[model samples]
Target: MPKPKIELHVHLEGTVRPALLADIAVGNGMAPPAPSPGRFADLHDFIVTWNATTGCLRTPTDYRIALLAYAEEAAGHGAVHIEPIVDAEPRLGLDGWADVLAACVDAAAEARERYGVSVGLTPQVFRGQDVGYAEEAARIAVRFAGRGVVGFGLSGAEGRHPTLPYARAVALARDGGLPFVPHAGEAAGPEAVREVLAMGAARIRHGVRAVDDPDLVTELVERGIVLDVCPTSNLRLRVADPGRPHPLTLLHHAGVRCSVSTDDPALFDITLSDEYAVAAGLGVDAASAYAAGLAGMLGTDTDRARLVRIGRAAFGGIDVGPAS
Candidate 1:
């Protein structure tokens, strides 16, 4: 049997393969956006590239296809659970985002029925983007609470924007019964992580830089906060020194709760399986990483228990359960 795996921080727009994007682009009678370069100079560079890559998506059907495609491919590679972030504003307004979420929810249902991959959608608010839109997304996510939306997140060039302005947005999401899981500690340093932690984030994406402050790391360990680490994405974005093992390895070794992810798998040319291997090579083994991923999921106890059962068989009898 294949190793059981869970993805904690993958973006929905970043999952569409070039071929899939081209197909959608051609179907819509528009030329596909230029291919993305393999490596980005920085997070700012990556964001610009990421936006260009999402130009192919113009309708809800395109979102449905992208969601289903990633679910199918990821499930084939042993991803038992995947939470995809969908946050493309301007290109999509609140109404369109709701449509995309509905389409993704229906598409996730199909993935569950056919591929058996448990997928939940996450709505993200860009840091410093309109607070009104951010609050609206939170309010909107409430309607899809158990249906498909599982988590709420903040994404942007963390260096350019502060997390303080979005506190209300995070509070709104939490009030709507969604977990606040935002991207931090990648483009910025430990302070960025602290800001989100203060906002009651359930888990953090790309929090490798928390290692810079040893005391902060201890606090994370004490709080059992899970930093969803993406080694490939980090190195590609230059957040992690390529010559060294990723910072999450240090955080993990120091007892910080760490989980593996592919922050933007297709955009980074990686899979959940590949990320697990990368972390393993950095001294974070698949079993522990997968276990942390499971523990960090936003699913209900009953949903998590069901996944634990699947994980046991998927990992060929390795057990990690009793999700709290």
Candidate 2:
């Protein structure tokens, strides 16, 4: 039986295994930066590393290899489904983005055939990108809807860059029939989460700070938006309250649907399994934590039920309650 896992808030560049990144970078004449001991420092540090890796991914084969490697690692972590957020505007190039996206889809399908794990793409727009860039990505997503692109996401740095600026792109995605999973409350406060809510994000990535605002927590619970929580990633970035003060428990108690994930396993040196263990330590029971993960991220009811069955089989007679 497959180990039950689903990761909804992963970035392909962030997930690149360090060793592979080194090899790929050297091969491309862009030597990877020296290995760092910490997962991440400030957001600026992360962005710098992000640019360095992005520079290495300059070809179709490079994109395919990066994606396939991520799929392999995700499957190893028991991930039945992995949605890699692709910030296509910068990396894939506007003119050749479609071909790059097609290559990614092919990689995903191949991973499923070989590893028994499924993968999907989420065309991600950087929060700092202007409205036109967001609109362009959204238009492309609309053009290729259902051709391996499962959802639309807003990734990258979140701050004073208002999510509302991307409203048109998000609306285009919704009109063209795609789900919105925007990153919020990761670096900012609950007000940032509220902003995404107003912009109609179906899921909130790293919404740990919602606990800081009881009203916002109530709003999230009432609306049933899944908080794509990344405990290790948050700790590594120092975005969340330290240790016990982390909002995983508070969000769970508040009735917000929340899922555990490794936002960037390579950087954090963790995996979905490690993430689950962290959540367990944070007060969620083993079985309930697993169930919360499945419920919070699975794209369909059928998939969610399949995960529940897998959980039951793996844990044996332990009931993993509904994510809701």
Candidate 3:
């Protein structure tokens, strides 16, 4: 087996291959979404495609299939752990969330038994939503913390919606023993990253723009917040500067804990192994990020120890240092 690594950022809906989504849509008696282009025009285009595709998931079986397929592919990428962010669909009542969570939990158990892969589901609240829905997302996340949901994710257009409006939701999740891992510094600048940090973000999704601010970078180093960086996603969405090397290189060099990931593997057509290779080619220590992420996951100590042992057995000496 290849060196066991961890993918700390991915989207549950976006992980489903377009072809598979078409199949599910047909099975659900709905028309499939239009075939996506080679790359999206922008985040808005991506979200439109996302909603059209994921809207077909009407049953628990669809959710199970999505997660298991992702786990199978991730395992082939030498991934022993994956944290896939699931959108908190406002239409889903608490009952609907429970069914989806139940399906995911079963799929996670099967993945562990079948592929030796551990799965953590992170429920995401969109920044574009009102406080009521965001707070409900937090409540649902808290309600299912240990069963399968391991983290709380804040997503949506951070540039348009400031974190202040969603502070209470984040705080509720954090107080309920769920780690806050919000999307920041992608659609916005370093100031957006600071807002999430102020909300007690344990890990940030695509915080590459923090490199634009030296003080913010230093604060990240001092506070030990991991930025789950996805190079392909950044490049595809035009979030990273095309003229410069990927920011994970600079962030790692500056002592910011950055874990390479596939934000939306199927949508980006990138794998976790490919992402690690990209980071390594740019002189980032992906192995260290894996170690840190494994140690920092909300899983129990026993699970962390087992994952570390599996990684060390493959790659040898995965350093779990300050990155955790």
Scored by TM-score, the top model is 1
Candidates in order have lDDT scores of 0.84, 0.75, 0.81
Candidate 3: stretches off by over 4 Å: 321-324
Q: Which regions of candidate 1 are displaced past 4 Å?
A: 314-319
State the weakest 10-residue window (summed lDDT) of model 2.
295-304
In model 2, residue pairs whose N, Cα or C atoms come closer than 3 Å (at least 3 residues apart or on different chains), thus clashing, are none
Better of 2 and 3 by lDDT: 3
Q: lDDT by residue for model 3 over 1-324, one digit each (tens)?
A: 566778888888888888898999999899987765637767767777777767778777888999999999999988888888887786666578767777888898898898888888888888778788889778877887787778898899877766788889988988988989899999889999988887888888889999999999999899888888888788778887669977887898999888878888877777788888887787776577686576556665666777767766665756753221
lDDT by residue (1-324, candidate 2, tens digit) is 345677778888777777888878888788786664456776657777667655666666777898888888778777777778877655566766767777788888888888766676787787778778678878887776766787788866777466777888888987887788888888788888888888878788888888889989988878777888888778878786474677887788777777778887776778778888898788765566566556555354555566667778777665455522
**Full ranking by TM-score:** 1, 3, 2
Model 1's TM-score against the true structure: 0.95
Local error of candidate 2 at 158, Å?
2.2
Compute the lDDT of residue 270 as modeled in candidate 1: 79
C-alpha lDDT of residue 124 in model 2? 74
Least accurate 10 contiguous residues by lDDT in model 1 = 315-324
The per-residue C-alpha lDDT of model 3 at residue 235 equals 79
TM-score of each: 0.95, 0.90, 0.94
Full-model lDDT, candidate 3: 0.81
